[model samples]
Target chain A: MENEGRRKFLGVCVAGATAAAAVAAGYPVFRYLAPRSGQGGAAKLVIPVGELKEGDAKFFEFAGSSAVLIKTQSGELVALSAVCTHLGCIVQWVKEKQQFLCPCHGGQFSTDGTVLGGPPPRPLAKIPLTVTEGNITIG
Target chain B: MIRKNTLAILLLASLAFLKPALAAPVEQPETVCIQCHGTLPDRLGAPVKLWRSSIHADNGISCNGCHGGDPKDAANAMTPQRGFLGAPKEKDIPGFCGRCHPGVYKDYLSSAHGRALGAGGPTCVTCHGNHQVVKASLALINEKSCTRCHSFDRARAIRDAMQQTEGYIDDISRRIADFQVSGVDTEKMGKSLFSVRNRFHTLFHDVDVARVKGESAAINKELGKLDAALKEIEQSHQKRRVAGGIAVGFMVLLALLFHLMKKSYD
Candidate 1:
């Protein structure tokens, strides 16, 4: 009777321990596989269409870094990261030249983010954006 | 013994031939300018050797890049139709180099040095050198270089002030590079540092001591912010390490508990 009681006790302990181990291992995996909450806060930005004029650029923070929204002389809307590809300096828009100029190493880029000249190995990165109901949304 | 020595010699020779291929790839291909000028003697050949060690060469700025010629075509390389500008006169050096470094050129022209450009003031080449220009540093403001034109006292004061801030920038840059090597995304911070460094370095061309002091304070404030951000990351990494240790300890303890329970049951 005492042996039967010991075996019963051992079975309970094993079952409980196994359940605890499964929970411990599976919870983290579940969390890892689950969709994250609060993923898009400040990830999307909105600016009014009227804010940018032809040949004008408006620099603002986008997705945690400096980004610029530009309306080309041809009235085409474009968005690009302001950071220069050469050494990561923020580029300034030259109103006269209608191009982005990096103050650091004089790396120049066109409105479309093409490297026009200087030491920048690559062009400025383009950011996706869209105009909807007179509000420009950038991501 | 003779056979072994010959084998070693052959191995060394082969390794020497392979060294170029194993080294960093040349971003700019061997231009016609290098092909021709590399062979000539004395002054004609001197620039090629000097320029090979230049900051320009490191940045892939070949002869055709500055002189304006077709790097590919040898015959048309120096032709005016190919947009070749051979060499600028002493007075035109600023404008020539200014084609790329517009901000520095503008600042240089406005400084005391620029005012004395033709009469006695130094041009870009005067301090930076012609083809052997390396990266600029506070070392350039030493007695040897600066005393050539004026007393080292004022230059020394400016250099001292600039050197302090440059030290901060260099430290921050090294820290950021360490983070980058460890696979952290340091792009934003690196760029911020670069912008500040560029602004600080270019401030020298203005040659205003009071302005330098004023701007150095402001730039130091910016550097402080970057330093604080790095500190924050360091703290978080420490916390992570501690948490990892705790997790490992917990796992080991759980294993031991299970092992004891099994032993008791057995």
Candidate 2:
């Protein structure tokens, strides 16, 4: 009876070990093969209205990458991805030119992310922003 | 006599390094041009040899392509009625070459270089040789070549403003190629880069520093997207390494558990 019990226990051990090995190996392989999840940052952010003045600009993280908020000379607010749509280089707010200038290929973006000139095929992407009670919020 | 022999040897040696600009079929019946010229002395045959490896030759542009003639009949090969243009004058060189490169010819005509053609000014042959024209590159804008015409300060400035971005584009290209070799679907990215690179090279023809500087930012932005995509791939690779490590640890644990179970049975 004890020998039979030993046999059963050994069989269980072998089966358990084999199953454990499979799960251990398979789980990681699945994880590795699976598509990456969207790892973006905060969905929404609020900024004080007075913090950004006319002709001023602010760069903050939007989603997983950098974004820019600019106050044009006309006291208008504009928000866009700091990343250029063309090659992903950061777009600079050319305050003097009153346009977003890309350093990589001289692509110019209007305050609204519309391609004003140069090789940029698309406009600067606009981030939805809401202003209320002297506070600005961005998503 | 010695100088002639030395020149012949040099010409023959240079032929070994010649490369066609692009691929094209090289099959055809032996034409009147190649037939008679094939057995000529090195002095006359040097041009034929050089022409063989030219972009024209690769595209099957034979003696008839530029110098029109009845290839099959040797009698009327050199006859003007057969439309054989022996050689172009210095000024006519642009129009001769323009017969094919019309766009570049038009651009060149309005350019400063074309304006000065034949009157102490550099012609098409000044930079691109007669029969040995290789691919045009930024190297053509260097001091030695430009200084031959005028000061290279402006040219140097143009190159400096562009060299970093050009290098960045090249680096991205190499990265894409590496990914391709590793079985990644990088064909689209390669084509995208190629288009931008071609556009950037077109700016070289303009030779306007202000314009090049102005457009550089946009080009850089385009390259940035490619870089981000590559970076994402690299991140995935890093994740794979981490997952692989955890998997190895699990295997070790499983081995220990099996050992304990064996001891129990023993």
Candidate 3:
């Protein structure tokens, strides 16, 4: 009788422990497989259009990297990755010259992100954006 | 002839000593400039060999890149219409190099060095060299180089001010590189660091000790923030390691318990 009782108890304990272990392992896998929340790095950003003016640039984090929104002197809105192509340094917008200049190696870029001069082998990357209802929406 | 050879030897030796970080030349197809000038004796062929170790060469900026000639066409390579600009004179070196490094050129123009240009003042070639220009560093502000034109006191002061911040930058850079090697997405942090480093180096062109001291404090604050981020990453890694160890230990203990239960049945 004693042996039977002990055996039954051990079996129950083993099954319970196994179930607990399975849950501990499966929860992480389930979380990993689940769809991420919108705020988890892929959400669209909205900025007020009034915050920018002619020949002005506003730098902000987009999709987890540095990006910029610029209003050119011609009243055109442009979005570009602020990262310089030469050495990955952030480019500064020169309001006077109406161009982007990489402080790292003096790489120059026009408002459209095209490489104008210096050692940069390529242009700054362009980010897509839209203006609607006095708000700028970027992805 | 012996004296000339000795001077050339001395120059080469000094350059080798000065440029400890010379990068290996990036392989490129031979251009007409290299093909033709590489064979000529003495002064004519020397530029090709000297340029082989330059930062420009490492970036694949061949003779034609700066000289503005058609590298594809040997016949029209040197023609005026082909947009070839021959070697610049001493006075025009700043303008020539400034075509690309306009910010540095502008800073140089406003500096004491810039004001002294054309009247025995050091042009870009004086310190940076003409063909064998390496990456700029605090090493360029040595007593021997600075004392050539003026006293080393001001240069020494500026270098002292920058040394701590430079150390911070280098340490953070190494940490970032380590993270990158481990497959972490370090692009954003790396770019910010690069901008800070470049801006710090550009401050040297101004040659003002007070400004360097003032700006270095701000730069150090930025570096401190980055250092804190790196520290947070390190802490997270440690926590993960400990958690992994506990998980393994728990699994092993459960295995032992299962074995014990099986033995009891037998």
Candidate 4:
């Protein structure tokens, strides 16, 4: 009876230790191996400054979306979203009026992207743009 | 008797070994809890992602931090036998949470709700609630929380004021555009505009003003003057529009009279 009890106790101890070890080692590996979502990949987009005329705007596709590039009459370059704040209407540069006009609701935005009139709740969303060696890169 | 003595010794040794294993600080009963609870679905039935951004996951805090008792067995977790470290009481909840988030607790204590709580008001669970703790998102913060206190009327009033001011700005901008188009020397006007712009940039964006003394107050004063000038410009534009309309109407009337005279002569 004593030998049997001893064997049973030893078995329980070994099993408990194994279980603990498995739990400790298994978790970090599980987390590390887990697949991640929403990690946006790299994108390459480049537009020459000289190509964009004064008071004109251009659009480029990067990072799975469209970005608008505007060159003001003062020769200053700014990049903003073509997506309107009201209902996602695409805004176009109206050179005659010198403003960004959304054809959807007559929403007008200033040359600097400030909401001038109509139903836009806020200014146009600005995407960070960089000028490198006369090349305009937006993300 | 000899066999009984040996049995007692073996039992004592077994207890000794088990004591150390059991006392291993309960081994954070959450090892298994995280397997299921950690990846629980969100409200949209999608998985409650952002585990990487979570404070629990970042600081090595696990599910066991809140729901205690041994997680190895579901039965033990449910019953919560001795050595249970389960959900704390509502009163003790603050202290328990404060252990990790003292800054938030301090801020809360100074707030109106915190003062009320101190004066025997409702606990933290009163406003935030318990068990149904969802992740706070930007949309949630802006839409749900702020609107609750701000009210529709207040929001509408603010929006109306903003629109009125924006209209005045549009008139000024149009004038500036016209002046530029007509080749007017707006150098003096540009100097004033730059000053106002500098003040606005300093106040709104660059808030550190000890290094730049009197900037914030200067911005307020300059903005007041700019607003007055904008109001004057709006009035002038209104006058111009009315005058232009009158002139067009008079010209049309004269043309009509000339045609009538020509017909009578014939």
The digit string of per-residue lDDT tens for model 3 on B75-120 reads 9999889999999988899888887676678888998998889999
* lDDT by residue for model 1 (B2-38), tens: 9999999999998787654344625778999999999
Best model number under TM-score: 3
Give the better candidate number (1 or 4) by lDDT: 1
Best-matching candidate per DockQ = 3
- Chain B TM-score by candidate, in order shown: 0.83, 0.63, 0.80, 0.31
Per-candidate DockQ vs. reference = 0.34, 0.05, 0.38, 0.01
Between 2 and 4, whose TM-score is larger?
2
lDDT of 1 by residue, A1-139 (tens): 6656766776676667667767866876998898878764457889999998899999998765679999998988999999899878778899999999886667899999999988899989999999999999998
Candidate 2 DockQ category? incorrect
Worst 10 residues of 2 chain A by lDDT: A34-43
Q: Write the per-residue lDDT of candidate 4 for residues B84-129, one digit (tens) a residue.
A: 5666765666555554433345445554445555455445455344
Off by over 4 Å in 2: A1-139, B1-106, B118-120, B123-125, B128-136, B248-266
Please provide, for model 2 over B89-122, each residue's C-alpha lDDT reduced to its tens digit, 9 standing for 90 to 100. 8899878876654445655677777777777777
* 10 residues in a row with least lDDT, candidate 3 chain B: B17-26
Assess candidate 1 and give its TM-score to the true structure: 0.73
**Alpha-carbon local distance difference test for all models:** 0.85, 0.75, 0.84, 0.56
Model 3 docking grade: acceptable
Give TM per candidate: 0.73, 0.50, 0.76, 0.28
Candidate 1 or 2, higher lDDT? 1
Screening candidate 4 with a backbone cut-off below 3 angstroms (N, C-alpha, C), the clashing residue pairs are none
